[model samples]
Target chain A: MNTCKRIRQHLELADFMAEDSFSLAIEQHLATCAECRRFQSEMLQLKHLLKTEQRVSAPADFELRLQIQIRRVRAEQRTVWLPWIPTPALSALAVVVVCTVVLSVYTSIPGPTGISQDPTAAHKPTPNSGPVQLVQPKPLKPEPAEGLSLVMAATGSTEPQNRPSPRSNRQHDLNPDKVLVLVRDQNNTENFVTVPTVIFGAQPVINTNAPRTEPADDAQHIF
Target chain B: MSIALSYGIELNLERTIPIESASDHELVAATKEGDELAFQEIVRRYRNPITNFVFRMLNDYDRAVELAQETFLRIYANSGRYEATFSFSTYIYRIATNLAISELRQRKRRQLFSIFTPWKTAPESPEDEQMLDLPDTRPLQDEDLIDRERRLALSKAIKTLPEKYRAALVLRDVEGISYENIAQILDISEGTVKSRINRARNMLREKLQAYL
Candidate 1:
């Protein structure tokens, strides 16, 4: 850097009150450069003006007031501990307050659907009357026959339709002697057991419209 | 006779310094041991300077006095934590500066609160206007009048600077604190202190060119 710039920086940055802060180099530069000299003079004047500022003193009763407050504080405080005494406690209290506020705010705002806040809510058994049942499928809707024929013919958009529903297949259950009994096997899987049509306790027709299948439970004897 | 250890305890020596002549750190050490006299000496020595410093920052006599008391009470209450690593003056000044700055911010917040909720308080005061203002109507000589006006302009210009720059400038120039102690007092680097003071001075010069 040039001497003038260097000297100006020194003038700007150095303590104006400190004698000998300026080196011979700055002095020589300032002597040669009038612009730097002017800048230095203005800065000195400004610093001097700032330094000579009129100070205002505390009121006459400041000490008396302070002493009274101090006496009261001494009387109230149980101990004269270090400055760090209250900082840790205050910070911990702040953390607890912030956490509670955040938790309450989070709970108040609506959450996404189907998710239970209490994890155990899903695990608790629901109260339902009468019998516990798995979700039941919708019943099949009847379609209109085109010509109302005695000989059964396909009806309603018959473009190689999907296989008849499990209920539809048993519509023509010709086996009056055997009935397809709905049974849960030992492994807890649903399987239809073809048992003889017998009135033990008279359940309605055993939903004979249900799909027909051979008996899978070897342990049970078919009547 | 070389004597400086008599303030806190009875030093068995040929001669000892008076309590009035004890160093600040020695006074602090004595205060730590529950010497109310030593602590009172500290308060007596610092009260005006601390009060004046806060007054310069806040430009309010009442709050400055109040906060200066708080600063001392804090020093007294926390005397055990006082370390001689930095000077007692720097520590005390730091407390006063923090209090003043916090008051300024709180005043600003209150002003904003009044602005947004005017019904909660009086009508909205201008942002730059002083709070709890007290005016002097006494007449002055021409020279004194000019000087007072200039000082007011200077104070106004100082107030206009941002908090960091204002603090560094006031501590360095008005209080005549050394840059090193200012760095400690403001919890900033010396370079940062210098930069802020430089910027603050330049800004003030721009605003107070006529007064200068």
Candidate 2:
């Protein structure tokens, strides 16, 4: 009769068996009923066996080894973000950007202007000239004017000195003495900074009031 | 000056390792502050019992040790995320037990493949071919044999149950944890834990009736 009642409370048996007063109540009930006594003995045996087996000893060095592993894993996690923070590829990209910017600035400087001109040359060829040529000049006599001409040549490209003179039209109306005087004034050494224009093939009319005639195309080539 | 010195001493004591004096919440708080020593203290304290529990559940020594280590590593990595909302013991046990269950599932899946092979192709049954097979290897000592058979019977019986029942039994009867903690670790209610443990125990009792 007691076993029938106790069997229904098997879930609460572990708790009741833990207390001395409740244990005495169970003991008194088991003593009065044989079936309840058998159930109590079985419960006791099973509990004893489980408790005895519960004390499983872990191997030595378990804690030390576990500590080492935990530390190693956490340290590894610290490095995980390092790869994510600034990868090798990102550093390489930064270097590429810096070098490109520096290279662009270095190449962007404008070099010294007009440093490529030469003296004693004929018509200066334009940058896009194709198969163009100028007639060769009769070599100038070894004269003191050559020194002054070279001094002007040192200024810049010969293209500037080859431009036609604005005063050449007026020179045709001047008398011979006046023309000579004008030529002397035009060739003033102090004015070597401005190279006198060369007349290639024809002499101009005198300055004694003669009318100006149109020069032939061949003579115009002196320009 | 003397009061300040005493205050400094008190502060140092508060910061020092508390051994068993500290609660799991305090240790978890320290670990969140990057205190590796505090985390190591937790591992040192719980390693043996937890390892023992996992080993019993898996029945594999190497696998239990591996899972035990992985449990603490997860604990340390996720310290900041730990809500003091639940017992730390339950959280770590859940990790260790879940890993063991996965391993068990994988092993069972492999064993299932061998089930289709015909029985005659397997080794001869000892009872059926006793004359041709080796002599009976059953032990003669009743007491020693009963204990051995009890262990074998229990292990076999536990394996036959579903993973949820096995977990509840291992946590309650095997590891001796409270039903509340078992429920927390298994993510079930206390009532469910009690029902599963009872069912597991009844199944085990039925299987081991001959030995009893």
Q: Taking the tens digit of each residue's C-alpha lDDT, what string does model 2 give over B145-182?
A: 77876665556566667778888888887688998898
The most accurate candidate by lDDT is 1
List lDDT for all candidates, in order: 0.66, 0.58
Candidate 2: residue B27 Cα off by (Å): 1.9
Per-residue lDDT tens digits for candidate 2, residues A18-83, read 425455556666567776565555555555555666445556877677778877876887888665
Each prediction's DockQ against the real complex: 0.52, 0.26
Model 2 quality (TM-score): 0.55
The clash tally of candidate 2 reads: 3
In model 1, pairs of residues that clash are B3-B17
Q: Runs in model 2 with CA error above 4 Å?
A: A1-6, A9-40, A75-79, A82-223, B1-17, B117-120, B123-142
Candidate 2 lDDT score relative to the true structure:
0.58
DockQ metric, candidate 1: 0.52
The numbered model that scores best in TM-score is 1
Q: Give one digit per residue, the lDDT tens place, for model 1 in A137-177.
A: 23333324321111111122212223334345424323333
